[model samples]
Target: MNSLKTVWAIAWRRFSENSAIAAEMNGRFIATVFYCTVLVPFGILSALFMDPLRIKGKPPRWLQREPVPTDMDSARRQG
Candidate 1:
């Protein structure tokens, strides 16, 4: 009877402590799924289709001097 009470007390304390950690782990798991399944793919597709979404910033001096081709043929063909 004494050992059962001790184990129950320990189990309750552990549950209280671990509940918050479990909630945080759950949040991170959800965010990871959101990024992998939705946000990242949408960002990539939108950037590919739209020009404004793609360009990060102004071109460097060398890039400005040497014109970069935008054609599909200019890009490496991988098959």
Candidate 2:
């Protein structure tokens, strides 16, 4: 039918436009796939082998919290 031909023409036009953009970024697309497929696993394996808890240094300051004061006065006030 004529309607089917019109639908195919529109679909092909959109596909061609999208393919042009994809071709322009082909290198970046490959790099992203490579990083996810390779570097991400390697990094995860390295972390597992390194014993993350055994790192010999002070933890980042943001992770350190001020000790909660356990004074009897504060506890009685809340209760």
Top lDDT: which candidate number?
2
- Each model's RMSD to truth, in Å? 13.3, 10.7
Expressed as tens digits, the lDDT of each residue in 7-56 for candidate 2 is 99999999999999988799788999999999999999997677667766
Task: State every prediction's TM-score relative to the real structure.
Answer: 0.49, 0.35
CA lDDT, every model vs. true structure: 0.85, 0.88
User: Which candidate leads the pack in TM-score?
Assistant: 1
**Total clashes, candidate 1?**
0
lDDT tens string, model 1, 1-79? 9999999999999998899899999999999999999999999998777677445665655533576777888687633
Worst 10 residues of 2 by lDDT: 55-64
Off by over 4 Å in 2: 1-23, 51-79
Misplaced by over 4 Å in model 1 are 1-12, 53-79
